[model samples]
Target: MTAVNSSDEIAPSRMLHRLTVLIVCLVWPLIWVGGLVTTYDAGMSVPDWPGTYGYNLFLYPYKTWLFGPFDLFIEHGHRLLGAVVGFVAIGIVIAAFWKENRRWVRWLCVALLLMVIAQGALGGVRVVLSDRTLAMVHGCFGPAFFAICVILAVVTGRRWRQDSDAERLRSSTSILTPTKKLAALAISLVVLSYVQLLLGAMMRHVQPTTSAGHFAGIVSTHILTAFFLWAMTGLVWLRLRRCGDLTLSRPGGILIFLVAVQIALGIGTWVVNYGWPSFMTWVPGSQSFLVQAKGFVDSMIVTGHVATGSLILAVSAMLCVRLFHRRWQAKQDRLVAT
Candidate 1:
C-alpha cells in the first residue's frame, strides 16, 4: 500500500513536468509561425474565422488538402497549431493544480492558461473583424504568452530549483561582482526588446499598399526601430562586460550575436524586395516576389526573434535576481577575509 501510494504521487508530478515542457516548446515556435502567417496576410486564407471551410478542424474540406492549393492551408494550418497549443496549455494548468506544491505557482499556471485562451479568442476576432489593429494586438499576445511559458519552464527546471536551495548557489561563487546599474540596464534592454517586437508585428500586420506612401513611412519607422534595438542590445553587452562577470557576459554575447543575425535577415528582406512597388504584396489578392520573400524572412525572423527574446529575457531575469541576492554574500565574504 505504501509503495502504491508513493508511485501514484510521483505520477502526477512527472505528468505535470511533461505537460509544462510541452507547452513551452509549442508556445515559442507557434508564435514565430503565427508571425509568418500574419506577415503573408494568410490569416483570411481560410475565409472562415475559427473553422476550416464550413466544417470543424478535422472535418475541413478535403479539397483544402488536395485540389487547387491555397493560402488557406498556411493560414488554417497556423490556426490548427494554435488550437493544439491552447489545449496543451489548459492541460498544463490543470496539471499544475494537481501536482504543484506552491499556491502561487498554481495560480500563475491557471492565469497563463486563461491568457492563452484569450489570445485564441483575440486571433478569431482579428479574422472576423478584419482589423489590422486587432491582428497586431494578437501578434503581440503570442510572444507575451510564450515568454510567460518560458518563465514557468525555467522556474520548474531542476537547475533553477536546486539553485534556490543551495547555500553555495547563494554564496560569492563569482570572483567578479555586478553593480546595480548594470542589472538595471539589462532589465531595460529586455523591456525595450519586447516593445520592438510589438512594433515589428504592427508593421507586418498593417496594409501598406492601401496608402503606399504611408506604408513606406511605416516601413522606414520599423527599420529605425530595428536599429535602436541593435543599439540597446550592444549597450547591454557592454554594461555586462564592465561588470566583469563572465557568467552574465557570455549570454549577453550570445544575444548580441542573435541580434546581428536578425539584422542581416531584416536587410536581406529589403534587398529581396528592392524593386517591389508595395510593402504588403503578400496580402491575399496580391502575392509577389517581395511578398514571398517577406513571408519567408518574416517567418524565419519572427521565430528566431521570439526565441531570442525569450533567451534575453530569461538571462536578464537571472542576472538581476542573482546580482541582488548575492549582495549580502559578497559582503560576508569580504568580512571573513578581513
Candidate 2:
C-alpha cells in the first residue's frame, strides 16, 4: 500500500479525505442524540426555531441548557450537534469542489450538502409546526443522511482507492466471473433495509388517531420486514464470501451482523415500550414485566435500535457500491484483454 501511495498514482487529497471522515464521525453522534431527542420526546423542549429559548443557538447560555431539564439538555444539545454537522458539511463541499478530481464525487458532495440543509429544514419545520408526521420524517431522514455520509467517507478513503486497484488487478487475472445476482441482491437489500427503517420510524412516532388495531397491524408488518431483511442480509453475505473478495465480504458480514444486532435491539425496544407480549404472560418473567416510560434503559435501548438501523443501511450501501465497482472493473478488464 505504501508502495502504491508512493508511486505514480494520482492521489486524492489527504485533507479532503480527513474532512470526509470528520463529517462521518460527526453525523453518527448527531444521529445518536437525534435518536435521544425522539426517545425522550424532546423535540419541542426548546420551543423555538434556529434558536433555543429565543437565544442564538451557539449563544444560548450553557448555564441554562447544560443544567436544565433533561429534555432541554438533550434537545438543545441535539441542535448544537446539528449546527456542527452543517458546518462540517459545508467544509466538505468546499474541499470537494476545490480539490476533488472526480466530477461525480464532487456532485455527491453537493448532494450531501443539500441533504444536510434539507434535513435541518425538516427539523426546524417540525419544531415550528410541532407536527408529529414531520417529526417522523425528520427521524427517518436522519438515517438516510447518515447513510450518505458513510458512503462519502468510504469513497474518499485511501482504502477505497486501494480497492479500485485491487478490482482492476482481479479483472486482469480473470479468476472470477461477474455476478449479476450479487449486484441485484445488494441493490435489493439497500431498498429493503431503508423501507424497514421507515416502518420502524412510523411505529415509534404513532399518531393520536392510530388505534390499537392499526398499531398492531404496524407491529406485524415491522416484524415481518425484519425477518425478510435478515434473510436478505444473510444471502448477501453468503454471496460475497463465496467470491472471496474481502472488500465486499467484510462489509457483507458486518451488514448481517448489524441486522442481527438490530433484531435483538428491536426486541429490547419492544420490551421497553410495551412490555412482554400478552401471549407470553404464562412465561416466568413475563408476568412481572412492566414497561418503563422514559427510563434510562428504555432510552438507550430505543436509541441504540435506531442507530443500529442506520448502521445496517450504511453497511448495505457499502456492499452495493463495492460490488458494482468489481463488476465494472471486470468488464473493463475483459475489454482490455480482448
Candidate 3:
C-alpha cells in the first residue's frame, strides 16, 4: 500500500472534497424548500409525481412555473432543486470512484448516492400516494441526508486526512477521557434532535388528519424536548471549549447558537401557527403581534426554524465525526509509538 502524504495526495482529493461541500450547500436549501412546501401546504400543488402537471420535470414551462401560483412555484422549485442535488450526488460518486482510495470512503459515497435516490423516490411516492404520513417521513429524511453530506465533507477534508503525528501525540496526551465523553455527548445530541424532529413532523402532519389531542401531545413532547436539547448542546459546547480544541469548539459554538435560534423559532412557529399561546397573550401588546397562520412571515419563520434544525443536526454530526476521528488517530499514534 502506498503512503498518502497530504501535499502529494491532496489535489485529487481536494476536488472530491469540494464537490462534497457543494452537495452539502445544495442540500441545505433543498431542505429549506421542502420545509416551505409543507409550510404553505404546497406538497400536493403540482398533483403529480416526478413531473409538474404531466410535463417532465425539466420540461415544465419556465414561464408558467416561475409565474404560477405561490404553491406551484415552491413545490416545483423543490422538485427541481432535489433533482440538482441528485445530479450532484452522482458526481460525488463518480469522483469518489476515481479519486478516493479508501474503501470505506468510496462506499460511503455510494451510500450517499443511494440515499439521494431513495429520498427522491420517497418524495415521488408521497406525491403519487397523496400520503401526508409519507410526506412527514420524507421531511425527516432530508435532514438525515444533509447530515450525511456534512459527515462526508468533514471526513474528506485535508485536515482529517493529514493529522500530524506530533499533533496526535499532543491530543492523545491532553484529554483522552474528556474527548470520549464529548463524542458521546455529541452523538446523544444528534439522536435527540432526530427524535424531536420526528415529534415535530408528527405534530405538523397530525393536525390535519388526526385529532387535536394527539397533535397536542406531540407538540408537548416536542416543546419539552427543546429545553433538554438546548441544555445538552450548550454543555457540549462548554466541554469542547474546555478540551481546548479549536476545530471542535468552533462547530460546538455553532451548535449552541443554532439551538438558541431554533428554540426562538420554535416559539415563533407556534405563535404563527396557533395565534400566540394563551400564556403569552397576557403580555402587554402581545395581542397586536399575533401572526396569522400560513401568512408569508409565518411561513418564512417556520421554514427557517426547520432549516436551522437541520443545520444543527449537521453540525452535531460533523462534531461527532471529528471527535471520533481524533480519538482514533490518538489510539493509532500510541500504537505507533509502542
Candidate scoring better on TM-score of 2 and 3: 2
Worst 10 residues of 2 by lDDT: 1-10
Model 3's alpha-carbon lDDT is 0.83
Model 2 bad stretches (over 4 Å): 1-9, 166-178
lDDT of 3 at 209: 62
TM-score of each: 0.75, 0.93, 0.92
Q: After superposition, how far is residue 135 of candidate 1 from its true place, in Å?
A: 0.9
Task: Report the C-alpha lDDT of model 2 over 1-338, residue by residue, as the tens digit.
Answer: 11222121246778778988888888888889999999988889888899887898899989988888999999999888888889888898899888888877889999999999999999999999999999999999988888888888877888767655643565544235438987999999999989998889989899999999998998999999999999988887887777767787788888878888998998888888888877667878898877667688779989999998988888888778778877765665455555
If the candidates were sorted by their TM-score against the true structure, best first, what order would they fall in? 2, 3, 1
Give the lDDT of residue 220 in candidate 3: 84
lDDT (C-alpha, whole model) for all candidates: 0.64, 0.83, 0.83
* Model 3 Cα lDDT, one tens digit per residue, 1-338: 32233332343387789999999989999998899999889999988887788899999999999998988999999999999999999999999999887768889999999999999999999999999889988999999999999999987887775554435445455554346667778889889988988888887777466777877788888989999998998898888887667888898888878889999999888877777777887977778874555767778899999998888888888888888776766665555555
The pairs that clash in candidate 3 are: none
Q: Judged by TM-score, which candidate is best?
A: 2
The residue-by-residue lDDT of candidate 1 on 140-181, one tens digit each, is 776667767766765555544433332443453554556777
User: For candidate 3, what is the TM-score?
Assistant: 0.92
